[model samples]
Target chain A: MTYCVGLRMKRGLVFMSDTRTNAGVDNISTFRKMHTWCVPGERLVTLMTAGNLATTQAVISVLEERSKAQGERNPSILEQPSMFQVARLVGETLREVISERSTQGQAADSAFGATIIVGGQIDPGPPRLFLIYPEGNFIEASEDTPFFQIGETKYGRPMLLRGFSEDLTFPDAIKLLLVSFDSTLKANLSVGMPFDLQTYVADSFEIGHEDRITRDNPYYNEISEGWGRALREALGQLPPYDMG
Target chain B: MTYCVGLRMKRGLVFMSDTRTNAGVDNISTFRKMHTWCVPGERLVTLMTAGNLATTQAVISVLEERSKAQGERNPSILEQPSMFQVARLVGETLREVISERSTQGQAADSAFGATIIVGGQIDPGPPRLFLIYPEGNFIEASEDTPFFQIGETKYGRPMLLRGFSEDLTFPDAIKLLLVSFDSTLKANLSVGMPFDLQTYVADSFEIGHEDRITRDNPYYNEISEGWGRALREALGQLPPYDMG
Candidate 1:
């Protein structure tokens, strides 16, 4: 299992993902699930994936290979004209990978499935965020739903639903995602640290900031401990149930 | 879908369950998923169920009818020697119902399965909680896991993990449960209002209190609103992320 989130705020987009992957309880391993592609000032795209590691890695490998090619031998995410087209290219590539695996005798729906969150900006348009399904279809984030979470989503969703706003500042947005991720990490063992986090400031057409938050990161520790204490304090403050 | 929780505390046991049942989004209905059986001064047992409504209802109905029968025509929960035995009875009954449905050509695992949380106290024994599965097996909640939640569980679990304690007061336990339930309700359309809440005080050998909290309940409204405000305020108080 995995937990990845992409938030599309008015100022920019925020992407965060956990690094733990497991084929089973005994075969746990660390793998980076966040991938980035950039043409510098022309375009910047970030992809976060969850599900079968082999399938997601294959899809990423295909995209990476295409991006490094010199000419039009194959269309690459770098060559996409808009964020929407970039999402389409990623979705199609993911479908092709899963299809190949299926033809090799693996079940498409269960064994080779993966979900992707694509967010970035191309020179011609505003930044966008999309959640691409295993079947190669996708949905864009809207004002009503400014965030998309894939993988072990439910444990952390309440915090997002309660705290998210379209106009949140970058700092506040990251804090919100941290709280959400903290909740998931505490409740589920499959979603472990360190987390990969990246932010794209609006209209920059470049990555704003990126960091890998490990268990020893002081700031991450502070957020985790502080949020836990604050939640307990808040529960303490709620009016006691009336037994009458 | 449903969300029901049972908490075992030093002072007593707390049980809360949402009443919504659905066969899909369009076929939603309200049905009590919490049932209680009491021998007044002898014992008090509460069962909260989740999963297929037909299987759960059949299990509960059979228990209810047997309890009302005279002259020991059949063994009933009233005749159980201990809360553990009561759980075993419930588990066996659930398994029997599913097996009967399976013999009628339904797939027992998928279509006729039900999960139950049973908590109560009988004379000469301490209060206990057990989670009964469809296969007639059960596990008791221990100090490590003081609460059990069935159905739509993930969204609300973090709160319980953070707030629960073996020594919580009855009122505090109920408050924690309401917070958990509120989170589930906000994130899921399938689990909705009017909740059944019951508390059993230690050594009382009978229910301490019970209430049906509906949408118009004022205290419920206060807790819901206050929790939302508290969470947002806590988020605001967290130190802002440094971009360095």
Candidate 2:
């Protein structure tokens, strides 16, 4: 299981994902789920994946191999004219990988399927964010729905719904994402730490900032403990039930 | 859809359930999900249901009918000597109803299945809580697992995990439950007010307190708004992420 979130705001976009993957309770390993491709001064594309590790890895490898190769025969993420085209390329790649795996007798919608969140900016166009389904279809984020979450999303959704705003600063958005991820990590064993975070400022055409937060990181620890204490204090302050 | 929770604490037990049931977004109505049967000084049992409305209503109707009828052939919940026995009786009744419906060609494990949370006190035994599955098997809550939630559970679970304590007072427990339900209500359209809440005090062998909290209830509104403000304030106080 995995938990990844992509937020599109007036100022920029923020992406965060956990690194834990498990086949069962006894078989668990750490793997990065955030992949980024950048052509400085031209475009920056970020992809976060959830679901079958094999499918996600295959999709990423195919894109990376093509991007490094020299030819128009194989479309590369770096060559996409706009963020919309980048999303289309990623969705097509995901569908191809899943279809190939299905021919080997694996169910298409079973554990072999994967979902991806694509967000980036291309020169001469505005920044964009999309959630690509396993079937090669995708939907872009809008004002009413300015965020996308994949895998184990419910546990962390209330915070995002209540805290997200179009005008939030980059620091505030990252803080909100950390709180959201902390809640998920505590409630579910499947989502764990060493989180990968990246931010893109609107119209920058470059990756603004990035970091990997581990369990021992002071800021992450502060948010975890501080949020717990704050919740308890908040509960205490609420008016008690009338019980009459 | 429905949302119900049962918490077992050192002082007593707390049970809360939303009254909304819907076949789909357009077909929604309010129906109480919390049922109580009390023979004061002997036994007090509270049952909360989630899943197929038909299955749950049938199980409750059967239990109520048998308890009032003059029959020694069928064991009624009122005749159970221990809380554990009460849980077993409810689980068996749920399984019977599901099987009966299945003989009519309905799939037993489909949307027709129902899950129940049974909690209460019987004379000579401590208060207890059990989560009865659709398959006639049930598991009791213990120190490690002190609560059980059914239907749309993920949105509200983090609050329960962070606020619950074995020694919480009845008032504190109710407050915690209200916060949990408020989160679910805001995040889901399927789960809504008015909520039914009940508490049982150990050794009393009688219901302690009960209330039906509606949307216009002042205390409910206070908790809902207070929690949202507290969360935002908490997010602001957390150490900002060091985006390097």
Candidate 3:
């Protein structure tokens, strides 16, 4: 299990993902799930993956190998003309990897499936966000859906639904994501720290602040503990359930 | 699908269950999932179920019939010697119904499976809570595990973990449950109002406050709307995230 969120904000795109992956409870390992591609001022593509680790790794490796060879025959996600095309490339790559794995007859098709959140800018186009399914289909984030979360999402979702807004500042958005992750971490052992985070300011065609938030990260610790106290206080603020 | 929680506090036990039941999104109906069998001054037992509605209903019907008959061989849950025995009776009945359904060759064995949370006090014994699994096995809630939630549980669990405490008053416990259920209701269409609530005060051997909280219930509306506001305010109370 994993937890990753790609949030589309008014000013930019924010992405966060947990590094922990497990085949089973006893067999757990830390693996970075966020992959980034950039052509400096030309394009920036960020993807956070959740689901089968093998399939995600294969997709990323394919994209990386293609990007290394500069040709139209095997275009990299970095070479895509727009964010939409970039998303399509990622989805197709993911589906291809899963299809190859399932064709090997080692496991069921669903066992090799993965989901992805892809977001970035391609020159003139605005910063866009998309959730790419294992079936090679995708949906873009819009006014109604401003964020996409994959894997172990439910525990962390209520906070996002209540707190996220279009005009949120980068720092505030990070804070919100940390709070959401904190809720998920507390509830599920499968999703653990340290979390990978990235921010991309719209139209900059460049990545913004990037950090690896570990358990010892002072800000995360503060938010985790402070949120609990704040929640109790918040509960107190509600009118008492008067049996009268 | 359903959402039911049985919370154990210092005062007694608090149980709440959503009334919504659906075979599919297109075929939805409301049915009570919380049932109580109390021998007033002798014992008070409450059972809240989640999973296959048919299996749960059949188990309840069998128990109802047995309780109506007076015999040693046909022992009813009400005739149980202790709260533990009552849980055993519920578990056996659940397994029996599921087994019968599967043997009829109608569907898979798991399709008829259901889980239950049963708690109460029988004379000379303290209040006890048990989570009965489909396989006729059960585990009691103790100091470490003070609550049990069945079906569509993840979205609402964080609140219970953060808010529940042994010393919590009945009103506060009910408030905490309402908040938890509100989160689930907001996140899932399978679980909806009106919610049924019942509280049993430990030695009284009688059910305490019982109420059916409807959508238009002022208190629920207040908590639902207030909780969102309170959560946002709580998030604001945290120190600002500084990228410095």
Best by DockQ: 1
Q: Under the 3 Å rule for N, CA and C atoms, how many clashes does model 2 have?
A: 0
In candidate 3, how many Å is residue A10 off? 0.4
User: On residues B1-244, what C-alpha lDDT tens digit does candidate 1 reach at each position?
Assistant: 8999999888989999999999879999999999888888899989999999988989988987655647654438888999999998999999999889988764444678889999999998999999999998999999998889999999999888888899899888888999999999998999999999999998999888899999999988999999999999988889989986
Off by over 4 Å in 2: A66-75, A103-109, B66-75, B103-109
lDDT, model 2: 0.89
Model 1, A55-174: lDDT tens digits are 899898888775565664453787888999989999999999888888886444567899999999999899999999999999999989999999999999999999999899988999
Model 1 DockQ reads: 0.86
DockQ of each: 0.86, 0.75, 0.83
True contacts kept of each: 0.83, 0.78, 0.81
Among residues 3 or more apart in sequence or in different chains, the pairs in candidate 3 whose N, CA or C atoms overlap within 3 Å are none
* Residue A229 alpha-carbon offset, candidate 1, angstroms: 0.9
Q: Could you report the Cα RMSD, in angstroms, for every candidate shown?
A: 2.1, 2.4, 2.2
Instruction: Return the lDDT, model 2, position A230.
Output: 81
Candidate 3 residue spans exceeding 4 A from truth: A66-75, A108-110, B66-75, B108-110
